[model samples]
Target: MTDFVEVDTAAGRVRGRWRPTTGTGRMPRSAAFLGIPFAEAPVGPLRFQAPVPKAPWEGVRDALEFAATAQRGDPGVTLIPEPSVPGESTLNVNVFTPDPDAAGLPVLVWIHGGGYFAGSPASAWYDGRNFNRDGVVTVSISYRLGFDGFGWIEDAPSNRGIRDWLLALEWVQQNIAAFGGDPSRVTIAGQSAGGGAVLTLLGMEKAQHLFHGVYAISGALADVSAERAEKFGRGLAAAGGVAPTVAGFSSLDEERVIALQKKATELGPSSLGSIVEEGLPLGPSVDGDLLVRPTRESLRAGVGADKPLVMGATDDEFTMAFSGVAKKLRWVPKAFLLNRLGMPKGAMRPYLAANQDALERGTAGIAGRLLTDRMFRTAVLNIAEDRGDAPTWLYRFSWPSGTFGFAEHCLDVPFFFDCLDGPAMVPLAGPNPPQALADQVHAAATSFIETGDPGWPVHEGDRGVVRVWDTPVSDVVDGYASVRALREPVS
Candidate 1:
């Protein structure tokens, strides 16, 4: 017989399973209630609409298994073992708690990353047992992905995926207490696109009540404009032979739309240039209603000034992706490639000079570094500066992957989760990642979630003091000085 733990939620009773702690989590075992629906699946009438709360259920629902995810297949974007589950009802949340009956425990709400188009919450790397053991109830959530979630339809709403996130947080606020989580002590965190989601949420006035703090890891901000979003939507519809309306999209098969989205959003001749110039084809946009203005603008206006934030990116996120071109483009002038990547002529020399270490790696390495710096590192600095001393902490994951030789994207996730022993760690973090670094990173994360500070120096007035997460983790001054060229007008 399966031994199940039952917890009564606002809508219904759920039966979850208990597993012994995998690594060195303090608790012996923690309960995981997977696939608890927070909203009706965005199908039929709900397609492309704001999430509607799940209706109350009659009997105890078994949450022993993971739920369906909007991401339908292995897209290789997340770099983790993110599985795609199939079903019409895909709007759900998975809860991992130390004790559903306990009172007033802190909560960590996680969002996953996949460039706003692909990613799944159902990844082993995200299981929250370690957090649960440490007294932080953890929740990983799912949202609509790609064109279906972000594509503009005249009759339907925009930013459906964004809406899904809002509704999921609302669910946490209302029901997390039933799972032994304190409603007031919730902190939202995520990597990549998910990191961007938390930042977006942090800047939302409507979302200020949902979570108390944020920790964004290598966030890839979308901030797509309304005009661009509409254009992408029209292009997607043209590719699918459908109208840019609810009726046309609803008539098409979900699988067909999925296929069309990729073709429609494929990168052009200059992949890096396209990403930097056009930005993601689908993601949270300035809808003038829910989103109001852009995320940075919202932050600048002090929309969510009260909440604490901790954010950073790996030193070489995705730089390794361009390593293969190192030899082929060895002789290529770094300035020429930066020009091709759409960096202004005025900015090329200065940008290249600022990133000298990357410059030494030849063309491919330099290009990759520019891509990471432009897309992620610069964004971090911008957000931190825009935030204007609102209780912020910054850090850089500087430890190169044991296998990849670069810090790389997704490398710090297992460390953040304190799950270096997790099944997916080796592929990204290599065979023997330093357990001590994981201890430091995870400890900081747990500390921040619990006390609203990551136990490091706070980012004040662009001092550039940042925690360098490598061997003998230590604080440094102006740690991000290398990327300063992109921050200012270089002529």
Candidate 2:
């Protein structure tokens, strides 16, 4: 039997469906309002500008299915299963709540990750059933991706994707009360690129009012420099046979634009080494207008010092990429690879000496660990350190996956969502993922959203503590000490 419900929003009336949430922490009366437009379709004249508010409509619109995603088709880039739904109305939000009549519940708004180029809000893994059951309203949102979102143009506004996020959060503030949520208590969270989004928002003065707390899992910051962004933008325009302006780009087919942008960043055999060394070409750029400064600089200058933040990275994020190439890398000198990764000449020996265990796994293992630290862990330390005395918490997902034998990237997301049984989870989390670990992660996240703290001690000073999530969770002082070498000033 189908159960139907309706709610009124600032835009219009929306009809959603109710369903039962089951399993270890199951609850009843959870309802979902999927595909609610937070902004007008970013097509035609709105293609390269900031998001426009969705025009109000009459009668109750059915929000039963997921909306169009910014990612065109299945790109198979990410481990999470984010299906692509095609349409112009890609700027949408999916809401899951326990009750529409109930009030004052905290709201969690999620942003999916794909290096700011590709990712979907339609993933089954991102379902808010579990969160709704826990007395919180969950909302997963969609934003523009790739060149369309972040690429620089001669006359177009920069950081269109970021603007999409702000508008969606504004929508939550204006309309979430109808879904029984407290807009004042909104907590923003995401994984990987989405995690990067959380940190970006944390440091953004314009975003401070939209969200109060943040949970950034394996956050990857891109803060692309204006020079690099301009270079890449020019290269992309040349490849597309168009000018770097709205007039020229508007001439080419959308498919041509996508192909040309991809061509600008495509990796070949030789470029693989520089993957983490050279930062991403497209993402939240340090535009002079909206983003007046780099994310770290903003944080260091006491920006967003008042918000509570919980952030962590998996033990071996991005290491699995090297699992099969160990033999090929056997003969290559580790020092050469380290140099190629932009490591300082003097720090190579010390960095290797500090990671003796990884050294035992040979050159491939060392390379993987270096890449992991350079790309993920080191940033976690830098952000925590930059925050100083602010309410910040650090953690490490040290539990190795049963299948891959390493605590890889994107592995902790299902655990964070507490959706162990969601689609495609087994392939990443192994056949039997521990129920208890999910419980711990989810509970801590919930606590952070509902309250301010995430259970463990707040990070304090240089040797702050980090909560390590393994089979038997433990809190270690200076848990990120291994990465201090990367933090050392290069001679």
The positional error of residue 57 in candidate 1, measured at the CA in angstroms, is 1.3
Model 1, 1-491: lDDT tens digits are 45689988889999999887766666778899999999998899898888999999999999999999998865554478898898989999999998888999999999999899888998989999999878899999999999878888988887899899999999999999999999999999999999999999998888888999999999988889999998888887877788888888888888899888877777744676878876787899999987899999999999888999999999889787677667878787767777787666477777777788777767877788888888899888899999996888999999988877778999999999888887867768789999989888988999999999899889887666899999989999888887887777577
Q: Per-residue lDDT tens digits of candidate 2, residues 1-77? A: 55999999999999999987755453576899999999999999989888999999999999999998999977774
Candidate 2 ranges beyond 4 A from true positions: 24-26, 272-275, 489-491
Candidate 1's displacement at residue 48, Å, is 1.9
User: Runs in model 1 with CA error above 4 Å?
Assistant: 76-78, 344-350
Per-residue lDDT of 231 in model 1: 87
Clashing pairs in 1: none
| Cα lDDT, model 1, residue 265 | 74
Best by lDDT: 2
- Score each candidate by Cα lDDT: 0.88, 0.89
Clashing residue pair totals per candidate (backbone < 3 A)? 0, 0
Show the colliding residue pairs in model 2.
none
